[model samples]
Structure formats: C-alpha cells, structure tokens
Target: MTTSNQKPFSYIAPGAPKVVKAGGVANLDLPILNLATNESSFGASPLVEQAIKERASQPNRYPDPASTDLRNAIGETFGLDPDLITCGNGSEEVIDGIARVYARPGDEILFSEYGFLQFPILCWRTGATPVKAAGDGLKTDVDNLLAAVTEKTKLVLVANPDNPTGTYIPAAEMKRLRDNLPSHVVLVVDSAYCEYVDDPAFTDGLELVAGHDNVIVTRTFSKAWGLAGLRVGWGYGPAEMISALNLMRGIGNVNAMAQAGAVAALKDPAHVDMVRAKTDEARNKFEADLKQFGVVAVPGAANFVLVKFPTEDTNRRAIDAHRHLAAENIYVRSNEDYGLDDYLRITVGTIEECDRVIESLQRFFAA
Candidate 1:
C-alpha cells in the first residue's frame, strides 16, 4: 500500500493545541493577562538576560551539539554527573528519544489517567499505542499503573506533580511501581514541576535512576525558572542511555542562546527559590479564594490549581467562565481536551494578576 509520494503511517501526530496563547490575537478592551500555558509569573534571572545578550551576537555559529557547558552547569546544580546528562530543546524531546528508542509498532506506552497530554503524542510519534491506567480521582494510582503493564508495554511515564491535575504520588509508591514493573521495560519520571513541590516524601525522580539502569528522569527550565521561551530541558540516566538519546536527539537541538541562558539561570538558585515561594503563596490563595466562593478546587503541589465549576445549575460553567475571563483579556487553561470539561486550570500569576482573575470570576458567578 505504500507509495512514493504517500505519507508514512507512522508520521501522523496529534492535533495542534486547541487554545492559542501567543500574539494577543483575541481582541479585548483590557490589558492581557495570559496564564493559559502555565508560564512563570516571574521572568528569568537577570544573569540569563546578560548571557543571551552576549550570545545573541554569534547567530552565525552553530551550538555545541553535546551541550557540554550547559550539562556542566546542570551537574553542578543537581550534583549529577555531567557525563550522564543529555540536553534537549525541552523535556518533550527527551521523551521523544525515549519513546523512539524503546518502542515501535505493536508496542504500548503506559501512562496514568489524566497524565500529561504530550505522552500520547510521543506514543504516536513512535508508532506505539498509548495505554492509560485508572486513577483515584485526580491522583495517579500506582497499583493500577503496575497492573496495567502487559507483554506489549515497552515504557511507563509518570509526570510527578502532574500537569493539569497538579497531583503527585509519593516516592515510595513510585519506587513500588518500578520494582513491580518488568526489568526490560523502561520507566520515565517527568519532573517538570518539581521545583514547586515541597513534599518531604516526594522525589524529582533522580534518586530512582541511581540504582536502576532502566529509569530516566527529565527536567525543564520552563516552569519556576521562567525560561519557557528558551526551550531548555535535559535528561539524567545511565551513560549508555544518554548515548542512545544523543543519537535520536536532533543535532544542536538546544540552540546557543538557550544553552547560555540556561547556564546563567542555574547560577541563580535564589531567584528560583523566590519564584517557587511566590507561586506557592499565590496558588494557595487562589485555591482558598475559590473555596470561599463555594467553588470546588483541588489542592495542588505545582504552580497551578484545578478548579471544578458547577455544571448543573448555572450558565457560569468552566467553559463559560474561561471565555468570560478571556473576553476581559485574562486567559486561564480550559481542559476539554483532557475530558475535564467541568474544570479550569489556573496558573499561579502575580498577586495583582491573580486578584484580577478572582474578581473577574466572582463577577461571572454573580452574573
């Protein structure tokens, strides 16, 4: 059935994101407060700007394909071996490398219910089926995930402090899942939001990889680091695994400016800490405010909180509230794609911005 001009069956990908956040395209009378993508309310460290300014002049040169300096900076911050770290455009690319290296047609990639939306996309990219296990409400159930593993399952993905739902399983449970999984199957722990989690029993997945050769942990600078525009992320695992990822990762995936900026960002731990504290404070206040308004909200460990709207009695449903806020030039995430039609995920913004959303939603509820 294959033809010279026809597309490969494996080339299909998921549709583009239904919500567009850039460009301020939506016409509104008020100033835009774009929080739809969970970007950091605080900008990156001042050092990052300096680094980018210096690197921007050399646009003619190619980046270091190995990302040596960036990896060294990451190693210094995390106490990891620079040799075991592999950089990518974002953690998404590392996930893609993992998927392509381990999976193929007829194989399955297991993810938790309400897992990160990108997991299915990566599965499709590798021509593997995406299998989801049941969860206990919004939290990922480790036992259900372990039980769902079958002979065809090649990889398992767990996004700690999971996106959208903003829930995370403790380290003990994550280890249990890995212990029960087959030795040949790979386990990937995505810790994109780890900087916001203060749970004593939770992990960013780095510890799990130390003793297990089959485990890889990925991290990103997009959240608390305030570097979403830079698209810098990395993976830590065994040296052999890192080698395989380098082969699959596009050459110079992380550009020269991203590398410099990420390196500078790592040097300013105080800035990241300040951002985390502020995010936590803002998220807590948002959740409490919603509760005061008789709106159901899920307590979260990440930078965003999920609020459930009353769908039965009023026209002020989640989608309606989302549009109402957007019309006021305040955008929050709507979760229709994740089958969470009744919920909205609000990224923690500055106190003033969060106050604006609260006021806007309060009016929506009253009207």
Candidate 2:
C-alpha cells in the first residue's frame, strides 16, 4: 500500500555526539588549551603554508579531478603505485565511497565495538547493517571480529591505533584478520594515527594491501602533517578497489590548495619526525602525571590518551573533571557516545600545554 506522494525509505539520521570545536571557544578571547580534537600541536609544516599561499592565486581554476600530481607524490613517498591510489576530501569521504561501491541494501558492515563512529554512519548511509564485534579492553580482538562475520558482511573497517581508546593490534594480528576473512569482503585499514606510533610491531596496512586485493589502507594528512584544515586523505588498494572508489567519489573532491599542501608536506620528513618526537615526550609525561593522581591512563600508540577516572561513581568523576578543565579554558573529549562514559580522550599537546593540564588536574583533584 505505497502512496504515490510518500517518500520511498525513511532517512536514518546520525545520532553521534556533537564534536566540540575548541577553536570556536578559543576565538572568544578565552585562554584555552584546546585538546579535544587530535590535531598536531606543532601545526602544519612551513612548506604547507607556502604551498597554500602559492595556490591561492588560482582560486578560480578547478582542481585536477584525478588528483594526479598529489597521488603521485603520495605513491612516491610510500613506495606504491600511483594507479592504485585514490584521494578524497578526507578519509571519511573515501570510506563513504567504499560503502557506496561495495555495500548494497541488506548487506552488513562490520567493525570493533569501539571503532571509529563514522563506520556505522557510513553503513547507515549505504543502507547496510552495522555490526559490532566485542573488544578486549579497548583493543581490537581479532577473534571476536572474525566470529562476528556473516555471509551478509560486505566490508570490515578497522581503525588501527583507534581513536578515543587509541589502541592497536600488531601486524601479524592484522594479517591473520585479513587472511581469515572471505575474499569477497573488503577490509579497510584506517591508519589516521599511524604516524604517531613508533612501535616496531605495528604495520600501516601497506604490506597487507600489497598481497591482498580485498585490502585497502586509508591515511590522512590531518594528523602528523597538520593539514586538518585542508581535509586531505588518500587510500591505497588494489587497482580494482581504487577504480571502484574513484567512480563513486566526486570529481575535484580534493581542492587545489589541499593538493599542493599535501605534496609539500610529504616532501618534509623532518617536520613529521619533529612532531612525532614532541608528541611522544608530551604523551609519556602526561600519562605519568595522571597516574600519580590515581587515573588509569590507557597505554596507546596514538597521539591522544584515553584516561579513566578511579572512582565507583566514574561518570560523575569524569564530568566533574571535564567541567573543572573547561572553567580553566581547557577542553578534552568526553567518551559517552562511544559507550565509554567514564573516560576522557585528551590530545597530546606541547610540553607546556601538557604541564598546564597536569597542573590543573592536580588542583581539581586536591579540591
């Protein structure tokens, strides 16, 4: 009994938590130590700024639709074939393209229990069911994910060095996950925070993609490169997967400025190394300081730390701490949306910023 005037299907709106932009608060003349978003404290390279300025004069011209030069630069940096790469406004856009190309209505998209929030949103947009596999203390449990797989599953998204919790599995575990999955299923390895990890055991999904046609690895310039404002991300996969993504992605999705900035950013390895070194120093100190206050900081490989409050009334403690920090113009992400009501995800800031946060927390707890 379908009515001619009625819409075909109901639109499922996203119910995720509101992302707080610390910049907005900082703009109000507040002395804010903004750490909500996991952006690089060091800022984008000088080369990136110069590139954007250089490209500014050509604002009227359309970007290269194929993102040819940018792709080539990325491929050169990673030692991959440019033909197997596809660029997007952000990795999220590429994820959307993957869903559109590979997932159909009645299909399922699978991810870990506390994986990236975008994974489920992408699934809903593509009319696919989002399935959650249980995790082991915020870490992706490969066995749980494999067990959750059904014949209906079309895509599996794994955010290595995952956001919020910031945990990751080793390369061998990742390989095992890929090897066990059905060949028809596409496995997307989201390595947004890969550059921050110095772990020898970790792999950024390049090796898996080299041998497996069903594997795709997505990276972003938003993290260590500090080009988040430009929204540039790229994916490397088998030629067939890249082709499928390119077909669904909008032409000129990556603008001229972003392309130029990304290319320049890639050429400066020293900038990235400096940012990583600073992040490691700050993160270690911050964790140690928090532990002195009885806070259990999750040992993660990413640039952000997931801190759990030690109290029976965990949620209240977290909320109180958050409000206290906000009063001092310091911001951190509350994890209520990710079923982690008792924790806060704080980005690793500069040394002084980290010290300031630690000092503020000490006062809040002492009171």
Candidate 3:
C-alpha cells in the first residue's frame, strides 16, 4: 500500500505506547488525593520559587548551553569535579543519552526484571537488545545480573531504592556487580530516590563512580527537592563518559528557569532534610497502618510503599482497589505492567493525605 518513494516503518516488539500512571490530576469534581507518582508532597523549596520568578524576567534569552553555574553548584554540593558532571532536562534524559551514546544496534543493555520501565524503552529505541535479569524477591540480585551478562552486553542499569518495589541492594553488592562487569560495559546507577534513603548499608554509587571509569551515577531534583516540574537532573561519572554524553546531548537541553531553580534547590540543604524527614515519617506510618489491615507491605527505603492486596474474590485486589480509590478521587499506581498484579505503589504523601487513603482503604475492605 506504500508509495514507491515512501519507506515503511514499524517499531520492534515491546515498543508499544506506554500508559504512564502519574499523579496530580486536575479539574476533578471532588478533592483528589494523589499517591500515585513518587513526587515530594511538601512542594519545592521556597528558594526555588524565588529563583524561577527572578529568572522569568529573562525569557527572551536562551539558557546557557553548558549549564556552567548549575554544574559547579552540583559539584560543590556533592564534592565532585565539575568536569565529571553533565546536567540534563531530567535523569531520564541522561539515561537516554547513555543508551544512545554507548549502545549500538546489536549490543545488549541489561537491567533487573522489574527495574525502571524507561531503561527498556530507551534500549529498544536505539535498536539495542534489552536483557532482564531475574530479581530476587523484587530486589536486584548481583549474582543473577552477573550470570545474565554476555559478550554482547554494553551497559547495565540499576535503580537503587528502585521504583515500584522500593527495594535496593547494599554497597558491597553494588561493588561486586561493578567489579564483575566487563570493562567496556558501562554501569549506570540510578539513585533517583537516594535522598530519602537512610540505611547505612545503602550507597548512592557516588563513591563507586569516584574509583571507576565505567560507572555513572544519576540523580534528580524530582524526588526530594520537589523540582519535578522543572525537570532538572544531573549525572556524575568519569570525565570521558561525561564528555561523550555532552557531545550527544541536545544544545541548551536545560532551560534558563530550570537551571536557576535547580541551583537554588541545591543550595538549600535544610529544605532537603526537612522533606526527607517528613517522607520517612509518613512512609513509616503508612506501612504500619497497612499492616493493620492485613495487607502485606513490602519493606522499602524510598519515598513510597508497595502494598500487596489479597485475591480478587476478597474484593481487595490491586485492580479493584485502584478503581475504588479512583471513584473516591484518590489515585494510586497499580503494578500490573510491572508484573506485580496484586500490588499497589502509593507515594508517601503528607500526614493528612496518608490518613485519607488509609481510611478509604479501610472503608473499601469493610464494605
């Protein structure tokens, strides 16, 4: 049916459109309690708002293509060399850049079975094979990952305090993974939820990047700093890897307002600490409350909790709960696509929001 001059095109398997279940729906008749996306419920730092307002005056000019000031501020905050840092529109952009720069058409990119969904999509877009290593009880298992690696493997991505499951491996295990991977294989450690983790055993992969040339650690302002709206993220790695990413990244990828907001957000450590404390308190309370309802709350180190519901006949399955909550204008993420059919991923919201969802769940089960 195609014209002689026109070429036919189609995406590969598993390259279908993804249905993202994000929070913060607008124009609802009732007050909506959104515990779907793992965003900071406390909002961004006051300084960020001020910075954005001030930067809004210069809308006529393009942002700094190199993001010099933002990179310097990030370096100062994390004790990293500015040359080793690369700022992006978001951590997802940096991840995409990694796949584009390192993976070839036939190369393999490996991740956990339930790792961040973006990893596979990024690989598929680049014509790279996405390999999934079996997870050990919803947690990244270094042994499984090592076993899955082959000569074709070009990159490995691990999301620490991983989304949906919110589970993570310890520092020792991460080091083992890095040491075992081939020198040509780039290990990308995504620490999007690192700010919320307080476990002593957990490492954000920064130290690993310091000692290894093939390792890169990506972080985001979306989680703790509450700059998800601005879409600012940064990555730290070896100078060579940073240079490669910079070469392939779009010019002026981060806008002026986002850069200004991120710089201010980085300066305010007290604000980040406050957000972390509130998230920890709310998450702990939510898990304990879920336990009271006989729901299996998966132990997590991130800003969200995964609650496994009973079977469908009990009217407490994840799909039923999601529908019931939606009718009440309370939205939570269902994990059916992540292969966790009976579990719901609920963001750690404010105390009031948490109480509302918990009470709603109680009413759903009671009825």
Candidate 4:
C-alpha cells in the first residue's frame, strides 16, 4: 500500500486553511475570519512592539544561544531558577526537544485523546509510540491515562485548558495523576492558556515543577501575552533535563527579537489584564449565543469556546457559517481532524469580532 509519491513522513497538516490561500478579504466566497488557531486577537503587547522595533536594528547579528538575559528576566518575574528554564523557537520546539530527550524506538509517549494535536505527532516523529487515553466529555480522564501507562512509558503530557476543548483537570487531579505516574515518567504540563484562568483550583505548573524532577511546565507568550507572531515559548524543568534538551537542540535556538519582545511582554502586566478582560467578555458572549442556538457547549477554562453541533452535517454548517462569517470578516475553527467532526472551536476575539461572528451565525442559521 506504500506509494512512491508520498513523502516518507508528514508531521503537519496537509495544507493551510482555505481562507488563507485565497487573496481576498473575508467574503461570502472568501470569508476571512480565523478562529482556527487560538491566537490572541488583541495582538502583541505595546511594550513588546516597542522592544521589537528597537531590536530590529540588530538583526544581522546572531542571537544569543544561551538566552541568558531572557532566562534571568523570567526568573525575576516568577521566582524560578534561571537554569531550569530553556527558551525555544516555540512550545512546539520545546516539545520536540523533550521527545528527543526521552523517546526512542519502543518507548511509549502518552497523552489524552482530547489533548493538543502536536503531542502525538511529536511522539510519532521521534520514533516513540503514542498511547492515547479516551477523554471524558472533552476533559482528559486522568484515571484512564494512568491505566494506559506501562513499563515502556517514558513521557506523559497534559495540556491544562486543553486545546480544541479547553477543558482543565483540577490541581487535586493533577496531584493524583502525578502520584499515580512512575517516578521515571516525565510529565509535561502545557499551560499555554494558563494566563486566562482565574480559578485557584488550577495549580500553576511552575509551582509543581519546583518539587518534582519528573515534571516540566511549558508556557508560551503566544496566548494572553499576545506574542504569537514572535514565536517565543519556554520550558521549565529540572536544571539537568533543561541542560540536556539545550545540549541536543544546539545553540541560537531563540532569536534576539523574540527574546527582547518576550522580556518586555513579561514586564507588561497591564497588557495581560487587558487581554484577559477582553477574552472573558468575548468567551461569555460566544458561549451564551451558542447555548441559545441549542449547541452543546463543553465547560471551557481557556480563552476559546468549544461548541458541539447536532450532527456531522453541522460540520458543513460550521464551514458554511465560517464562509458566511468571512464575508463579514469573521472566522472560527472546525474540528474535523480532532475527531469532533460536528464541533467547532471558536477563539475569543475582541468585542467587535465576537459580535461579527455572532451576527453571522444568527444570519446563517436563520437563512
């Protein structure tokens, strides 16, 4: 069944979203709303923008491979040990680094079925077998995950405020999962959307990383910090592990501009607050509107809303609605690849963007 035309490996999706390929702005035929990726609609922080502008003059020089200054900045802000942090091109690279460190042929990399898309892909690409546990109503079933682990399991990944679904397992549950896992297993808690959560029940993975050698918490400036374009993300773990990852990953991993922008973004608390407020408002409105239309909405702890439509035809309806919204300059993600064919994952945009999507949805369903 092997085909010569096929590439030996394809780690990413087939192609970009259709709307992106077409040159036109959001239209009926070419609607341009992008709720596909949960990027911050608020854009990069002003502090980051100014820093990037200032740093732009020195692009010719290679960036610091160690990223010592940025690491120190992160340590100062969060009280983390600077040596424990490893900055990467993005969280994806960090995940790749983790896979590279822990995985080999016959090693098992485990994550929830409802977890982020990249975890399994990274595992497969690194020669590790992926063992997925079924989720409970879009939330990761910690019990199932623990049951699936075996002697060959080397890594376990849990994304708090998981992607597509935006579901979270509480701090107690996390502790339970940690206790249940073997000490040799590396736990990766992806808190990419952690900044949006106000609940105290959810534990910050940073705090957990301090006590556990097996734990690594990965965070990104891509979400609430609004630095998606810059592609800056960092991983926090035991110093030895971080050192190993950096060693294998080589030097000059993070660029100067990204390092500069992330430092400024971390310093700008006001920007974080603004993004948090906007996301809360938009998510509330989007969820309420979906409920009125009889769509089943899973409880979301992140900045996006997960709504399940009535049937697989709703997938088409969602696509049609996405096209209709693009005509009105709005966009959302259809979760076909995630096995939720009847569902859509809508990122919380600004108030106006939310209104545009809501209005477009109303009109589409009405017609």
For candidate 1, write residues 248-333 as lDDT tens digits: 99999999999999999999999989998888778777777887566787866887888898778567788878767766667677
Better of 2 and 4 by TM-score: 2
- lDDT against the true structure, each candidate: 0.85, 0.85, 0.85, 0.79
**Which candidate, 1 or 4, would have the higher TM-score against the true structure?**
1
Candidate 2 lDDT tens digits, 118-230: 99898779899999999997999999999999999999999998988899999999999999999879999999999988989998988898778899999999988888879
Residue 98 of candidate 3: its Cα lDDT? 92
Instruction: Kindly report which residue stretches of model 2 are placed more than 4 angstroms away from their true locations once superposed.
Output: 1-29, 313-316
**Candidate 4 — worst ten consecutive residues by lDDT sum?**
1-10
For model 3, the superposed segments whose C-alpha errors exceed 4 Å read 1-28, 312-314
Q: In model 1, state the lDDT of residue 315.
A: 79
Between candidates 2 and 3, name the one with more favorable TM-score: 3
RMSD of each: 7.3, 8.1, 7.9, 6.3
Q: 1-367 in candidate 3: lDDT tens per residue?
A: 0011111121112542232223444324557565777777888878998999999998999999999999999999989999899999999999999999999899999999999889889877899999999999899989999999999999999999898899999999999999988898999999999998888999899999877889999999998988887999999999989999999999999999999999999889898899889888888888888887777788878878888987746666777777667666676787877899889888888887889898978887887
Candidate 4: tens digits of C-alpha lDDT, residues 100-218: 99999899999999789898897768888989999887899999999999999999999998998888988888888888899989999998999888888986678777767898999
